[model samples]
Target: MSISPDSTNQRRRLPGSDAPAQAPSGRGLPRHLLGKLATTPTHPAITVGETLLLPLLAVVLGLAFAPQDPLLTQAAFPWPWLVPVVLALRYGPLAGLGGASVLLACWLGLNVGHWDVFPQLYFLGGLILVMLVGEFSSLWQARARRAETLQLYLDQRLEHLVRQHYLLRLSHDQLEQELIARPMSMRDALKELNQAGQDAHGAGPTPQQLLRVLSQFCQLECAAIHPVRDARPQAQPAAILGACDGLKADDPLVQQALRTGQLCHINQAVSAQQDTLYLVAAPLVDLAGDMYGLLVVRDMPFFALQQESLQTMQLLLCYYTDSLSMQRLAQPIVSQVADCPPRFAFELQRLAHMHRETQVPSVVVALEFRPQALKQDLPEQIMRLRRELDEVWPIEGPERQVLAVLMPLGTSGTAEGYVRRLEAWMQHRSQQSLAEAGIFTHVLPLDGAAPLRTVERLRAIAHA
Candidate 1:
């Protein structure tokens, strides 16, 4: 999810305050004193140790350097007051109060025999002041801690909301692109359909991909594509395709999508099973406006089914249907290609290039045999061939086909020589297999730079 800079900034603002507070520094004595008081101990044990040690040291200092004048007793002076104030500044009111109490007790004990050493009013006044400062310091520290915690929580929530907003924006942009590039050709539709099939066969499209598209297009959730069966007497949905939140392929809403070639908006279809607010079914139609299948989406927001979203939904349905159709048609050939010796596919591609370069006749040699005939042993053989080919000639194409150097940079005679070598290689491999598999080669003569005809010829041969 992409977060807009403004939204991010807004979210990061200090909690309970619009602007961040500047750190307190020098100038005013009370502000400085307050700042000192706010510094809480990071470690509880450290605060406790300091509280224990300071009062003990104050008592020893008062005894070791006792004042002779009773009116100016050292124990009643600043030393006793300073120790507790320091404790309060460092660890807040509790530590300050505890430290002050110990210092006051020590002062009274040390001067008990000399009544003139300290005045009762002087000691009482200093103790009260120290306690007040400690309590105030603690209150300030508590407020600051609470503010910091609240700010952190607000920052996290804001980040999450921003992320979600960005994702929705990105989805909107993608939908816009699809709309602009609409009225897609049959070939493009087929290509998209093929890609979807490949994704399904491999790892399947992620929920993000499905949901983002559905939400953008305002599609119904229960739509799916099913294979036509011969003996079942009724068509069964083959795979669960795209869907919105709570709708599944088995829902009656999906059957509605299949039946109507127009947008099917059924509010409260699954309100009993789930809190379904709305459902919309759009037909997947080709450029010719021929219905191929249906797209079912459920629980979509009312605003999502606007005309623009509905149009995008129609386009998505068309694209998905075309992909499914192409996959169905290409499956047999792809299976056959997969079963063939891995090197053979590469050799065929190489042969195509050789035909173009040499302007000589070249053929795509394929071994014809049903997969069931050699199913037990073909997988191991294919795996071994794949590894060997990867080591020798690792070439990839846009179509994801394996290609080899069958007729490299060669003359007409070189082309023929390569063909004979390939034939010999096939003959040697055929001896180990007991199937109706035999090497069948189709030759095509390239005409000038135009390899289209040659390509068509090779395709025809493969089809045959």
Candidate 2:
């Protein structure tokens, strides 16, 4: 979905024509004109010109066919009125009236001194017809505009979903390779990032930690992270690795990434001679569309600059941005809960935000274990059964231990399924039912409440 600048500049010429096969808009002029005509013009001059041009042109053609009946009042139907009807439909009632005014002017000019012979009924009927048609046109045009706006939003949404799907698949492949070569998994790296972002002593992650994390996962050998201020990458590098050069704002890849708010690289479809100093340029933008910084890669392996590597770099940058946002969202909840894990708090706030904006439900379930169940390791068994999308925070109290599970996008049925799964697993391991094992369950749906409230409610259940 990302269009390279070079592709936009390059135009294919036709075999027999001097002009380019496609217009600069990439779509031809007819489509462009249609799009233009769909929207009402703000300039009165342009609308007036359009309204006058068509009716006058029709008058000229009518004069050639019959000079005496140029107004077409003598015809079976007032054929000349079609021009005004079309103008009204295209531009609303005002434009149609303008066109009718042109016709009226023409009629008055022809019958300058013979005003007594004016066809009152003919002009009256034409005016009434044009107005009615114009009103109908205005109504349909409004509907069409609304439909087009909705379609545009859906198209953008679909494009975003497709891009995310591609990134997810590419990241999976890159992650598998990383898992084989590196000891740290993506989750652990994100956890480290979350901790660094949540560090109260500092503002988000330090530049050095960011460079190290990128180098470890993205294989960034010579790169620099530049803080973006005033909507531009700062001149000085925030962090640099190896012999990375200073920030180049004019670099094509950097410019493209900044313009599109996406990761861009020299390997994209572009002219071979395209000028660029960096191999990759990625913006650190979160899900909320806040830009924290820009990452520029100078010296990376050619194979590593492929789609998978670029995706990994983009994914890490996004995760870093999300960590910063998550820290802010979860801070209130963490402050209230004594033993809440940073990871748990982050996911809780994230899912709560998601539910608020998207109406995608999630569940917070607290499982309390009696002292008798401590011998059975029921809490540990439940931890093992946690889904990838779920986060668990274990609360150890004086009398009992509790496992608070965060299930994202979980419905009532999903909560029941999760509890059922846990019960079955506990039975298989301990040869006893949930009640027999002295395990208690409390379910709370993440709804229209503050995240801190949700966590506080869960804490109350754990203590109860």
Candidate 3:
């Protein structure tokens, strides 16, 4: 069922006063602060031991290998400063500062007794020189780290883009293949629609015709079309085909379809329900935006709900409804003359005569109707039942009109079977009665009955 926008309004409203509350119901900490408390920060990559170990190792090697004389300070060639430079580059200014601290401790401990004024000054100058180098190295290494990080980021981004492009291309190709396959179903629907268009007065195809197309082309097992309502199971159905027994129109799926004004799957609409019966219900809306009826389908073949086939079903139903609109807008029926019965019978005879050599089964089904008891949709339903190979004509009398259906290749049994089917269908489809129809109805088998006898049988029913 197609859900209209107003479906939201179907829900019951809660009773309440129209006044604002004095305070908000929710009382708690702000969201950002709560999120901060909920998450833990990641540990720094460089540990304290790693930062101190490199600097301390460099100082121990320099002191143990250097000359004992104060004048031999230049002999170490500032190799200890390499430790500070490396720390500055690898871990920024903090590690550089730590390296500087290690260097001062080694200088003070090794040179404590030998430090004269000039020697101490030399030591101060050396310490200052390495600290300055450490600071400069820290700045340069930070920029290098940033550049390396940026290079990795760009490489990763480019790789992702290439992968995405390939995926999109593949998807496009698949979509093209799907599109190509889609047209086959549409073509079939269009072919049937064109034939329906050629029906009398450019009236569109009938509902049964549309259902037959949908069933055959879409491979559906059961389907129905009825006026759009919160339809209950026990209510009369407008037109039904195939095997859809025990299905309810008031199901949540049906209501959802009605409310949304779009097709809804039975499985999707009621997830809590264990059993899945039908697939979808499509709204048959007229041109004026009112829902003329609903088309409910079930038990389609596996994977039959392809995009193309569903769309074709919708289009064909629209074409069928259009025929009905045209037929409705056409001129009203005029009263028939007294000779109309014989002429109607003659047409049936003419068609039946043509099939005599082939001995194809043929018969006439006459439905007699009293003027006052006729249902408004009775004429349209009768028209809908007419096959392409069949003809329908009105036979008028003093009190009523009889609709005579001519089946050119039908047998007496075929006509008789149709009568039983029609009677049963009418019992569930409407409140119209056989008594209200005011006549007995029977098949006029062109091949089986004698001309005089057939005339007598028709007259007996016509005047009953």
Give the number of the best model, judged by TM-score: 2
lDDT of 3: 0.56
lDDT of 1 by residue, 117-214 (tens): 55667667666777788788877777666555445534534543453354355456665555554444323433554455456662223333433445
RMSD to the true structure for each prediction, in A, is: 27.4, 10.6, 34.3
Off by over 4 Å in 1: 1-39, 59-77, 115-118, 176-464
Q: TM-score of model 2 relative to the true fold?
A: 0.56
lDDT of 2: 0.74
Candidate 2, 1-464: lDDT as tens digits: 44355543443221112443222555544556767757777898888898988988989989999898998888898889999988888788998999999999999988899989899999899899999998998888766765654454345334445545654565466577778865566666666765776674324777678788878876778999898986699988888898975887888778877877767667542554668888778788765567878988889765555544555566667656756766676667667774677668876776676566556678988888999888878788778888855789888867888888888667888889988987888778777888889898888898645887877776676666
Candidate 2: list runs displaced more than 4 Å: 1-25, 29-204, 215-222, 229-231, 242-246, 267-272, 299-312, 351-361, 411-414, 424-431
Q: Residue 436 error for model 2, in Å?
A: 1.8
Ranking by lDDT: 2, 3, 1
Error of 1 at 332 (Å): 53
Alpha-carbon TM-score of each model against the true structure: 0.29, 0.56, 0.31
Q: Which is superior by TM-score, 2 or 3?
A: 2
Give the per-residue lDDT digits (tens) of candidate 3, residues 26-140.
Answer: 5686558966853423356444665678767876665566545323455645556667666655555666667767766666777678545334554566556656766786676
Better of 2 and 3 by lDDT: 2
